[model samples]
Target: MINFPDDIFSEPADVDPDTLANLGPLTRLAGVWEGRKGVDLNPKADGPEQRDYLERIEMQPIDPQANGPQLFYGLHYHVHIVASDEDTTFHDQVGYWLWEPATGLIMQTLAIPRGQVALASGRASPDGSGLLVRADRGGPGYGICSTDFLEWAFRTDSYELDLRFNADGGWSYVSTTMLQVRGRDEPFRHVDKNTLTKVAEPRPNPSARIAAGKATLAQAHGFTTIGGGAGKGD
Candidate 1:
């Protein structure tokens, strides 16, 4: 359990502005990536159904964040997947991957358009080659939540994601989700796995750019000063 400090409102001093330097095991994940030959398995009325897919993911560092005394370095990420045979989106997700350098704590917060969201947590060394995180059905922390209709039809019981950094500068991951489908006595295991290759490097975080003197304060805040007028990110 985490010990609470008496001065809960006090923020940490000397927080680093360079988010990439503090991301630890998640540093390698900051970039645009593409993966073909991905696989997914899901429950169907008759049985399980399997399909191949293509995926693209973008993970860019965000400015360091703090909540009172607690500090976090994180990445904002988006995932897009499509079936190999079609162009329509098969899956889409957006989330944040956060790490606490002081505690070696790793966390993943994800949301799907299908009205489900989850927070998963784990721990790993800064130089670890592999990582794992998990979330359960219901809890105050590290748990899952779903909409009413989803809860009645396809209840998600748990989720697990295992990651491995390859020797060739690539990465692979396997995600498994346990589901309790309506009118079914047995639970089902929905699984997806893929190996991704980097397609592009990530740009520096806003704070990092400011610290390096590469951007003005207004620009770092996602504003463009056009003849004294301002425009924010679109």
Candidate 2:
């Protein structure tokens, strides 16, 4: 297993919105959003099952993070999803959406409460509508890991997700996950798709807004910028 050194990280700072300009393709996705009429398709013993669900997501910009010379701008996100019929949760996820301005690297780290974790990576242009990212089972840098039960029953070979922004400022994603089921000789392609529309605008990063508000009040009272930036980060 790979281990991260504690010395690698510096003091955490409050998130800054001005740094969002460097996020490239991930910049637009930083904010609160909702997707209605999400449809998911999965492999069932009998056949394919389809279900409609609703999702509420909040993606907030974080301040720039650095690993020595490597820098990343990203969003910290939380997603809660519910289905029309079932009282239990349809899906729940927490992850980070990171963008490397220097290398055009995009990374998504996802963790579900159901003992599953995966990391997906890909590249995208700033103005491009379609973005594709990939992650595999045994990669050193970009890979997926699972618990013993999932690894034994449904081994995930690779995952690919494509996202496109429509004309109306909405976004849609098509996710394909290749799984090796224990009983099936052939690989099963599990697919899911959904189009999310903007239900509300995103709020400014917490620290940025708070600092800005304080500055505004101070300015009204005949004050000036402190010695320098607050240096707060997400």
Candidate 3:
């Protein structure tokens, strides 16, 4: 038997407009980053193949999102990778890193061009320096999904990502993917790791920009008022 909220249609009241202020554990990820020492181990027909890659990632804040009473502040991100000698993209990914302030829940939604998507979930403290999130093949909430061709050729069993904020003000991640390839006797562990340094700062969210605009206008108006009053007094 399953139980759900009766007032599911009602959304949360007094939601915060500033996403960066409410991102909790995901706050450190909002920036443009680059990694040159990325390493990837993937399964091939013959055996495991190792490759080095250069990776760039950009994460920016979005407006507050709500699901009935549950609210989320998240960062929209894009990742692109290329080999050292190649100009073409080796891998590309887009995702959202979400943090729920009310529950201390961290979620990552990933979508690749290779017909696979996943939602991974975990828990973390607001000021924590590390996080680990996972999604299993048959989980009810955090689960993996793939196209039929991928399911038959290279079935994915699980996905996990471990993230850490370094003392040097950079971030690093290790991603492990469990795969059951066709005709393989054992599942293969596909792994990738990289430490990223910030290349650029992030832009403010839409709501924050609006707030700043309003503040600027108010300050201009006050200046004008004070100028006119001083002229009359003179």
Candidate 4:
């Protein structure tokens, strides 16, 4: 079972709105974005295949999450990709971009359509522009998981994503994944890169909207209550 705190409803010092603003650099990514010029390299039966694909990634801000003194502001994101020539899904990923305000820790949880998942983590400051996160195989902390078939045929050893924010209002990323294919003498480096432009904007959190609605109702009913912050339990 997923391990989480038990008393998650207890009031904390900082509430959801504060948490939203404190997510560091991730606040800039809280919107829909698309890129058509993503390039990917993967292994095939004969050899390596290089292809160009289209990518769409959407990251939305979430209410702050806390475990006692530890606080986090981040985005729940979905990444979708398709080959330029074909309409079928080339790749799909769902994950979270988490940031710890107190520790400058950035984490990424990735779940792909190919029956695999990983939790990658690293550290960065609020001032720096670039970020690199990584995960390794067979590690309990931030590690990788794969299906039995995939594990036997093509084992993935490590995954890394390097993100760079451009001066122009755009962002780019380079992904390098190391795989241990069966019958191969050495590990293969599969690389992919993409640059994204903002096609649209993000919406506010549902809880925020609901809270606004509740405030309206409370005002209509003349009830004044003060409880605003991230809860402390599951």
Candidate 5:
């Protein structure tokens, strides 16, 4: 028995355009970041194997999104990783990090090229130093999904990610995925961790850019008179 809102299609009347200003906990993640020291541990047929890798991540602001009365400010992100000794790509991922200021809710939606997608949710303070989100195999809201091959060979049971903001403006994350591999008696915890340094700042969202452009044009045309200032002639 679930309740439904009759006005589900009605959007909010007053929506803010500045995503960066409204991002709350996700504000620190906006920028281009690079990490040279990344570690990955995964279960192999014989046993667990460790690998050192390099990682780059880019997070940029997106315009405010609305679902009825619900609004979200988010960052669209892409992550690329490569093994230290290899030239080929070790892993690639794309995701969105969303925050709802009204509810103190944070969500991460991730998609990997290997045919897996997940949505994880958590709660955080506006200025929290750390955050954690998790998703399970058979949850109603936040859950994990995978392709047929992955389901048959290495089934994922749960996913968890913990993020920490350092004092020096850098950030680090530890991600663990519980996998139930075929022929294995127990679940394996595949983990990855890295610390990233900001390389470039994020750009304004489209709505903010438009508003700034309008303000610039108004200033150039000496429209200050409209706000009680005298015109150039008087």
Candidate 6:
């Protein structure tokens, strides 16, 4: 269990404005990436279906966030996927990838348009080359939630994601989701894997850009101070 401090209302005193520099293992993932040879395997009415897909991902830094004494540096990420044989979208996801430097706590909070959302948690070294996080159906902190239709049809029992950064300046990930299909007696393992190449670099978070005089407050409208600083938009 995580230990809680007595002073829950007091925020951290010295929060750095540079989010990119403090993202720990998530630093390598801040960028736009594309993958052409992605693979997905899912359960079908008959059995299972496999498809090749194309994926594009954008990961941009967000201003530092805090919950009282808890501080986090993170990225706002969006993923779009299309099948190789079709122009229609196969999957779309948006999420935040957060890291707590003090505890090496890494978390991923994801939401899909098809009525599902999940929070996964894990631990990684500050300079690690790989990362992993998982979520189960019923948990207090890190867990999955779905709509009633999804629960009755294709209930998601668990989710896991594994990521590896390569020496060739690219990264890869494999995601596995356990599903309980309507009629299936056993759980099905739906999986997807892809290797992405960086296509663009990330922009600095709002506060960082402002601190460096690269942007004005008007451009950083939604940003708020994290620690011992002035009020929002001040």
TM-score of each: 0.94, 0.80, 0.87, 0.83, 0.88, 0.93
Segments in model 3 whose C-alpha atoms lie over 4 Å from true places? 1-5, 125-127, 214-234
lDDT of 2 by residue, 1-234 (tens): 534455665633543444456568886787778887788877778766888888888887765777755678888899888886887899999999898766788999888887888899998846688678889999988888999998999899999989997888878899899999888888888887888777665555443444666434343233445783433322
Best by TM-score: 1
Tens-digit lDDT track of model 3 for 1-234: 635579887888877777888888788889999999999999998899999999999999998898987789999999999987789999999999999887778999999999999999987645687899999998998999999999998999999999999999898999999999999999999999999999898877766655666434333233335555422110
Residue pairs with backbone atoms closer than 3 Å in model 1 (clashes):
none
Residue 44 of model 3 has an lDDT of 91
* Each model's lDDT: 0.91, 0.77, 0.87, 0.81, 0.89, 0.92
Residue 27's C-alpha lDDT in candidate 3? 81
What TM-score does structure 5 among the candidates reach? 0.88
Ranking by TM-score: 1, 6, 5, 3, 4, 2
lDDT of 4 at 69: 56
In model 4, the worst 10-residue window by lDDT is 214-223
User: Candidate 1's residue-wise lDDT over 13-53, tens digit each?
Assistant: 98889998889889999999999989999998899999999
Task: After superposing candidate 4 on the true structure, give the runs of residues whose Cα lies further than 4 Å from its correct spot.
Answer: 1-11, 16-19, 125-127, 210-234
Residue 35's C-alpha lDDT in candidate 5? 98
Local accuracy of candidate 5 as per-residue lDDT tens digits, 1-234: 645468898888878888989998898899999999999999998899999999999999998998887889999999999999999999999999999877788999999999999999997644688889999998999999999999999999999999999999999999999999999999999999999999999987767766766434334334556655533221
Cα-lDDT of candidate 6: 0.92
- Between candidates 1 and 3, the one scoring higher on lDDT is 1
Give the top-scoring candidate (lDDT): 6
TM-score of 1: 0.94
